[model samples]
Target: MPLTDAKARNAKPKNNQFKLFDTDGLFLLVSPAGGKWWRFKYRLGGKEKLISLGTYPEVSLAQARARRDEARGQVADGIDPSQARKALKAARVQNESTFEVVAREWHTKFTPTWTPGHAVTIKSRLEFNVFPWIGERPVNEIKAPELLMVLRRIESRGAFETAHRIRSICGQVFRYAVATGRAERDPAADLRGALPPVKPKHHSAITDPEKVAGLLRAIDSYQGSLVTKCALRLAPYLFVRPGELRQMEWAQINLEAGEWNIPAEKMKTRQPHLVPLAHQTLEILRELHPLTGTGKYVFPNPRTSKRPMSNNAVLAALRRMGFEKEEMTGHGFRAMART
Candidate 1:
């Protein structure tokens, strides 16, 4: 029978591999591989045509019968199933662009236009966070809610700023995809006003000049590592971000000139900064010279000179001094000096 409606239960398996029947002038074969397939044999425009329907039991006998009827109707209308499947496949290939492939293509095209450091920043964030999440999803199919889910994960970790930056990069990739006709619209668009606005957590700032005098006075008495002491002294005088401060290389500083040159690669504003060192700042550097003078970084990790110290080194030093994160961070010195 072309349509077998029997249900199997506690029964022995059939060894017969070929189960065949005819429906609507089409021969249907159910192979031992469990493939319930359709084949149409006819002269199409004076050429013989053979078409496969699909696999079974997924395509049951009843479904195959319906498809067989549909194919006969298509043949009557002078349409070919094989040719139609080819067109459908081509359309799917055109519409579907994997996130990683499109992202890298966009990155390759746009990185040339960005400043070197900014380009690295964009790439690092994507590789570590974004790629692992949506890299396999089709670019056109990524919804704003899905994007929100990714950003919210970062936000939950208290990385509010990083969440914002990643959101920006995702937006950039989508824009590139749109320009190249890989995607229809930038789902990350209008997300600027859509995502949560970043608010730097309120920290305990030293507002009183007297308190600043006391904090500086207390800093002088701390018996910490020379690297940390120097880091503390320089934090107030140089007032660079923690990353810039930690990544400070010997190649960028000139102790003789009483100047520290922050490289373009390390700065938040994407430009090198020049700090005219106070005598006190120079003294701290001079004291630490014998310890780290041969290394790549002035404050390299105690365990490695090729790599910078962990970002938390200075902050951890502060915590040991009974200062909580909200009270005074290494970067808080900048906020304090400004006030």
Candidate 2:
């Protein structure tokens, strides 16, 4: 007879473990310790085998019988219920190892090789853009169409170049998943030319020696704050990036050695750079030293020494002196010196 809920609950343990039989090979195994577990005994391939359906109360009488019937169906179809259960368990484990989890792992592994700014940018892009859509989904189950939907949202925001970069990053992540046996293929690989092309922007610069001399003369006659004036004068000589020059510190300069050693962390190339100071550059520094030598930054903010000079100060000064942005920018100093 099939076990009723009231009888199963009242069933007590004896001296040893015993089985309370139900129809179709289903039974409740009552242990000596008073534990009641549902079990299904069956024969497959000329061998007898048994599997646990679940525990009493949790599996209940009706649910346990339903699971037993499902397993019996599989057995009739020449399938082993045990093997099918194992396959389902494996798939559940793989699903828990999601795309977001793998992508973040990939980010952590590769961030050490990138600059701090680059690392932050990459992380922010993913967290704000990609993670919300398909992050929780299984990496192996993420098809090309779903990934394309994510990229199209980014492209819709007018960040065409960023969309392309994100696709490349997704490809790297997918390839990493493949190497780790989590995914079969990179879905991003099929997205070639799927986004719009990036437009080229060239920084404007005046490279002629006569024109450069004229620029220097204009900077000298300007009546702006002395800090900005100093930066303007030093820009042409150092030819360092605007950011590098603005963040320059007195500690990095060696007056006796006539060198400016920029640390690797501050450099875009991730290598320390030595700028051999010309006599003219040294003299300019000497003149400005008495005013700002005690501060952390050589070109500290004009109003207060708490921060470095504004990045736009030099550009704004050039505009004040009647130079258009199309003619010369603060970054143009490098190309001008290069020419």
Candidate 3:
């Protein structure tokens, strides 16, 4: 007889396990420990076989019958229902392993070796440029043309350099996917020379000694935050990269030793650098000391002491001093020193 909801729910466990048979090979197996399991029994290739449907209360009577009917239909069509279930599960797993998933895994694994700023830039590039386009696709199935379409989108904006950077970053991600056995090959590799090369633009500087001296006098008499004015003054003297100069920590400066030590992670070459302090530079530092000496950064943000000054602070100061973008920039200090 076919089981009903009442019969199935009211069924009790016995000292030994027993089955309550329903029609169409569906039954409820009540175990000795009061556990109820719904199971399906069928014959295939002239041999009887059985498979689990679910649990009693969880599967319920009607749901168990539906599942049993579905499985019997598969057996009638000469397909092993268990094997079909396994194949469906494998396909689902494959669908979940997407390019974004693998790329994020790779990013997390290698982020420890990169500087914090570089790590943020890498993540930002992928999130803004790559992820929205191809992130949901399975890593193993992504093709070369698909990746090129993504890069071409970046190129369409006249950002040739940014396009090239995204391509390199994608290449690294694909290589990581390959090394981890998720992808077959890097599609980015097939895109060699596919984008226009970026032209090198030099920072503009006032190379004439008299103009340089004039710029210095302007900085000295500049009307700005004392911290920004100090940074402007030190830029020409130290000639460190603008980033390194802005991110300088008070702990790295040795006023007594007359030097500022920049750690390797902060430098572009990833090597530690030492800048010897001149007497004038030392005097400027000593004068600025009392104001910002208590903070972690030598030039902390005016709004918040936790972070260093904005990267635009120096450039904006130069702009305020009547220097056009084409004439001079914060990076111009480096070129000015070199000349």
Candidate 4:
């Protein structure tokens, strides 16, 4: 059926469905739910296939027919229409201007001068904090207030440190946008005093000595699991951050050598760290081996069965031991050890 304007209007929905066929290798498929769509059914690589021609009357029959001919030409050229369409879609996505694009470009330009940790920190801040807010908006179109809104959100959570970091990230992104001619100037420059400062007490440590002694005793007293006992006993002996402790790979620890070599990438410094396994640390490792030595990570999370132990897994054990947050933290052992 050659669908003219009159035919289109005359086409009726039956039981909430309609069909048009026998033109431009297309059958207009109408959903029982009230959406009229065009589909071209054809043979490709000896397999019958269907390609959507979008919806009509927004996509008129004439437009559907035009698209059918284009797809046919692609088939003649030995290119699958689906793949061709996918390639075209990808090209269009690449061509579209977006905030992610500008931010990445900004990241590329500035990351070379930054330490690896700084680069990672900046990227993480942008991905979580800034990109969601204005990464999709045109850099030139972003207002000061809009940028402030992003930082204020971080401030609201009392993550003032992260908020300041986002401010720096925004400044870098906007500068990159300006250099690349995507934006006019950095709107983040004048917003220094816009957010609350991070408090001084959040130095990422456990504060009380008496509580820590109690927590240590609880770890020693823990009889629920040998792995937990080893981890708790060795906590202070290998006073690396909790993350460094948990990400301990089997290959990284040498029981005979009495050392756990934390690779730089895993360490906060991104430099290889030598954990001098005191006799106490090695003794705990020996016991931990019978339980988890068969796995790659020294302490794989029992619940996940794949990843390193949960970051809070050890901390949670402390919680179960009835330790208060201020009394002891996973990092508090470091403070106690360092002091």
Candidate 1 lDDT tens digits, 102-207: 8888888866566677778888888888888988888878989888888888888888889998888898889888887878888887567765787777556565
The per-prediction CA RMSD against the true structure, in angstroms, equals 13.1, 7.9, 6.1, 15.3
Model 4 TM-score is 0.56
Give the alpha carbon lDDT tens digit for every residue of 131-208 in model 2.
899899899999889999999999888988889889998999999999988999999998887777899776888888
Rank by TM-score, descending? Answer: 3, 2, 1, 4
Local accuracy of candidate 4 as per-residue lDDT tens digits, 262-314: 87667655567887788877877787787898888888887754788877777
Q: What value of lDDT does candidate 4 attain over all alpha carbons?
A: 0.76
TM-score of each: 0.58, 0.68, 0.69, 0.56
Best by TM-score: 3
User: Over 4 Å off in model 1, which ranges?
Assistant: 1-96, 107-167, 191-199, 202-204, 268-270, 304-306
What are the lDDT figures for the candidates, one per model?
A: 0.75, 0.90, 0.90, 0.76
What would you estimate as the lDDT of candidate 2?
A: 0.90
Off by over 4 Å in 2: 1-96, 143-145, 179-181, 208-210
